[model samples]
Target: MAGIKENWVTGVGFGNFQKAYQIYEKEEMIFRAYVNHAHNEYLELAFEGGVIAAILMALYLFLLLIAFTKIRRDALQKTAFLSVVFLLVHSLADYPLRTAALAMTFAYMNAIIFHRGFAECRNQSPELVEVDHNGDKLFVPVGASP
Candidate 1:
């Protein structure tokens, strides 16, 4: 909070969180181990890049919610929506987006949600194949037909 109070406009600059945190660390808390993040993603963003960054993140999330609502009927889209919900919920306790792998996964899911071809694919039912084995019949996607 002290860090944000001091740098609320433009922040201490990205990647400089540790330095800023050091300055704000209370003398009594100094015995504790150093922390590079605020433990909350939104507060971390505001601490690192200022209020504008936080606002931008909020706008991005709002847009994602709108997109999710528009395509929630599709199974794939529903999965994407769940992934986003997980990320948002997780952000309250950890900075998952700061991790490269998680960030890439988030980006990938967003790409899947926004891809133009997804809408077309959703409208087309998968071709199916009927298979017979041991006097039993089963149906599978055409891609798995044998």
Candidate 2:
């Protein structure tokens, strides 16, 4: 077990897969399909971050669900949902959240969703009145033109 750990720590066991990723004209595998292969190296992020990665991933997914369900803006809600889906799917074969730019994007998306959700819920409806030039308050029908 100690030897295995040492080997992993030093990257002794993992080898370059240039051969594994070779292309054949006769086989004709598409780039899209090849990139989506189930056995790519998905361990870099998990191994580097250890248990924190799993915990944060779970938390992000939970927050994503809340954002999708609770956000009041239709466009923002749709955008958040699509973002979550894309990130989740992309995580399967790559640790997108590990890169600085992608991680910032993920954080930005979460901020928009959670902030908007909380803001909308807290400020549901407020009293408003219109004032005329004479400084008199005027009541206007909700749908009437001013």
Candidate 3:
């Protein structure tokens, strides 16, 4: 909390978390080992990147959820969604995203969730027709089809 209060705008700069943690460490909380992270991913992000970064992260998660809702139902999609949920829950206790392998896996899940090609329109019906515009295809009501 002290770290956030002191550097809630631009943060202590990425990768300087260890040094900043030491500086912000409380006398009563002294430990033999150095503290590296805030433990909680969201808090760490806020402490390291400020409020804007935290908001951006929240927006990204919200958008990811929206994309997930739009994607076709499948085992892979279900697995990806479950994995993301687990990661999010785990983030409350530890910074799993800090690990490169986990981060890449998260990115892969996001790609799988956000790829429009993997989405199956729930509104598909004979009344709608697919139209292509500038190489992007979308379904529209027959009367509105180009």
Which candidate has the highest TM-score of all? Answer: 1
Model 1 agreement with the true structure over 66-87: per-residue lDDT tens digits:
7876784578877977897899
lDDT, ranked from best to worst? 1, 3, 2
- lDDT of candidate 1? 0.84
- After TM-score superposition, the amount by which residue 43's alpha carbon in candidate 3 deviates from its true location, in angstroms, is 0.8
TM-score for each model:
0.77, 0.51, 0.76
Worst 10 residues of 2 by lDDT: 16-25
Q: Model 3, range 7-117, lDDT digits (tens) per residue? A: 998987878888888887889888787687878998888888997888899898889778677655566777888888889899999999999999999889877666665
Q: Across residues 48-139, which tens digit of lDDT does each residue of candidate 2 receive?
A: 33455546657877877876776664667568668857876787776576568877887777666667545554556545557574787785
> What is the clash count of model 3?
0
Candidate 3 deviant stretches above 4 angstroms: 120-146
lDDT of 3: 0.80
Off by over 4 Å in 1: 120-146
> On a 0 to 100 scale, what is the lDDT of residue 29 in model 1?
80
Ranking by TM-score: 1, 3, 2
The best candidate in terms of lDDT: 1
